[model samples]
Target: MSKAKKKKKVTPNQQTSSSKWIFWVIGIIAVCILGLIVLSNMSKGGGDERAALTYDNQPYLGKESAPVEVVEFGDYKCPACKNFTESFFPLIQKDYVDTGKVKFYFMNYAFINNDSSRAAEFAETVYKELGNDTFWKFHELLYKKQNAADEKKDVLTESYLEDTLKEVSSDADAKKVASAFKDGKGKDAFDQDMKTANDLGITGTPTIYVGGKKFEGKTIDDFDQMVKDAAKENK
Candidate 1:
């Protein structure tokens, strides 16, 4: 055999070129991986955004098959929330809710005070123990009382809530309602509502969402038009 050709040793420049090529390949792969990871996180974030607005399993009004969905985040002791119930809500109820164009839901954002939380828990108890119809009835009664008040008062004692429940429905066992409130039967639901409100960045009561977007309108007419627009879009 011819004397073995002296092995062609890699020169430094050639070795450096080879190393540069390998580094480039690794850099490209790393960039692709990072892009995939970023895309995955974006997808998950989008899912969470949608889930935040679903308002699933919460108390609702109108037909279950209603095309558009509306949600209200409210506090029992919030004057603005009471104003919504007294004024804006009835108009919506008469138009969209009663007409079966929208399904409306309510969640407690009881951030006012201890009484606010207590009222939320009491309402939850009414929903759980009494039923949906009675819950709505109780809800209206609570707001009505809030409206009738001369000024804001922390009157939501256990006894007061028990009395109010009895007043809302003669069929209600005041003692049982009181017992349920005391036993923390409604605390879990109230807490869940609180967590959802927190996640949604709700800092005030009477925040309304229509068709998975926050309502920014300042007038009832705007809200009405929004509902109409949302209904049309859903169809």
Candidate 2:
């Protein structure tokens, strides 16, 4: 009294077709993985997809025709930036910047605090009003003053920056620098720097680049070696 149900059998051709489809899918997936690996390798190998070195009105040191270029994205209020300025940057300056093998440029990435932005604005004003040589001097002086003060205290006040300007450059007009700082003559330039830093995915201060590639080295010798390699490539 029990009824038995019969099952339908799949054809060999149908099974082969399904297997081919699965193989095609697996092949496509493998190709995609290989493509991703190649793109990642290209990105790691100094591809142009990363941050570009733009010299738009930024202050720099060394010869304009220098074969290699070094760019630093820094925040004035960052303690690490202070340390780099005091300890590592001088060696870079002496070895590469002063020697004219590299052109060093500074860009503002003022994200630490409001005073960081203020100090960056003041620096932009100096670069606009006082010129490159004075800007470099004030750049050093600002780091010196930052290291001399309490780290937690906001020390880069307008008056303090003005005094620092006077201390660095005797011929600089204090009132003009003050008014420029207030009226935001340097704001656009500073904003450009900020935008560049954001585009570069920079999350910290003192991010440096050599020959338009992000410098991943942790030590001074590593940086010097990078610069030397870049110089050789340029030649």
Candidate 3:
């Protein structure tokens, strides 16, 4: 008769170690999942308490009475902001602002550098002196100029800004704007925008809000749909 076959048995210590290893792996996975959920919620603006945000006295594009309001917190020196302006803003302006379906405001976040803040102040000065139409024109021109410069160079000096203002509007008073820049005419408005951005927990460039809801997508269709949804909800 053949000898009885013998089975190798796992020891109690080995079993306990295996169980602990499995639990450790599972615990790590659970922590990772929790982190992802929290980040996703923060990105969607779900974590912050929504404040009564307003655009009164701010430089804006589109009709004041438009049903939907779109606000962008942007940095002038941000390449992503420039990309959005060149690639996506045309569609937004054509489909939403021009059609009066959405009111859009560009607020300065000024995170890149001091020059970023200065550039915003310059735009504010233009808005205060030259009116909405000229301010929008200057706004476009600023991004265009920023896009054309070398990546390592800083080209947004006072002289260059004054020249851009003149190019955007023949009626722009270069001397008055220069004096205003010297006197820091736009500091209060820029500071107010910064305060609002901080209060809303905005920490990045091109953070867009559609009808007071954060827009997380980056496509034309996404933006168009958000505007439409906001309009529909209000109606």
Candidate 4:
């Protein structure tokens, strides 16, 4: 073989070697990235599947297709839920939810161990009767007045519930909106919520699951690190 023939053989071999190394490096990096993400999500609940609630036509605040889920099964009459909503939700909504770092859901159940279930059911019914925004306002107001106590929680009575609906309404006859809360209109929704809660194994107010792991707390601060840790995985 002459000089050009020798060069051609060597050049082809060098190119082939370089291509093989490139593919190997790329594959390794891709796997590392994928493993990191999987590990991150699995940090919570060891990757167990959990229930997602869909009632009252509520609008979700975070990314619909998030890799992590944070579901809350709470009672409108639960004091812990009230405290979390009043104090912790602001931080959570500001941080994880508003930033689209996590997918969030709310499951309303009446478990103050009292007639509060009636209030919860009525709230759900009114949300359907009213609109999304009005329902949200009504829900918040109910929690604000609610104090889930040990002896007996003070669930806002029918009149107060009606006042809340009216206060949040836009002169649209909130009384008609409040009417949905009466009789058994809300009972069906209340039952469905309870069934879902039972299925999810929820045992308390402010029961939260991040990636299927229970977040034990009466406030949002308890799950801060978990959220950060989960985000680091996705990023």
Best-matching candidate per TM-score: 2
TM for candidate 1 is 0.74
TM-score of each: 0.74, 0.83, 0.75, 0.65
Q: Which pairs in model 2 have colliding backbones?
A: none
Which residue pairs clash within candidate 4? none
As for model 2, its CA RMSD to the true structure in angstroms is 3.2
RMSD of each: 8.0, 3.2, 6.5, 14.1
- Model 3, 1-235: lDDT tens digits are 9999999899999999999999999999999999999999887765333446778889888887799989989988888899888988888889889888998998989887667887899988888877888888888888887853543456778888888888877634866776787898888888999999998888998899998878877678888888888888789
lDDT string, candidate 4, 1-235, tens digits:
6666553455888899999999999999999999999888876545434435453344345766565667778887677788888988778878888777777767666666555666677677776676556667777887776644532745466776777777777545577755666556667666777888897767778877776566754445568767766566666
lDDT of 1: 0.83
lDDT of each: 0.83, 0.85, 0.84, 0.69
Off by over 4 Å in 4: 1-59, 63-67, 147-155, 217-222, 228-235
User: Which candidate gets the maximum lDDT versus the true structure?
Assistant: 2
List clashing residue pairs in candidate 1.
Answer: none
Which stretches in model 1 have alpha-carbon errors above 4 Å?
1-51, 147-153
Q: What is the lDDT of residue 228 in candidate 4?
A: 67
Runs of candidate 3 with Cα error greater than 4 angstroms are 1-51, 147-153
For model 2, residues 70-136, the per-residue Cα lDDT tens digits are 9989987888898899899889889888888899999999987788899998899889988998898
Model 2 residue 124 lDDT? 94
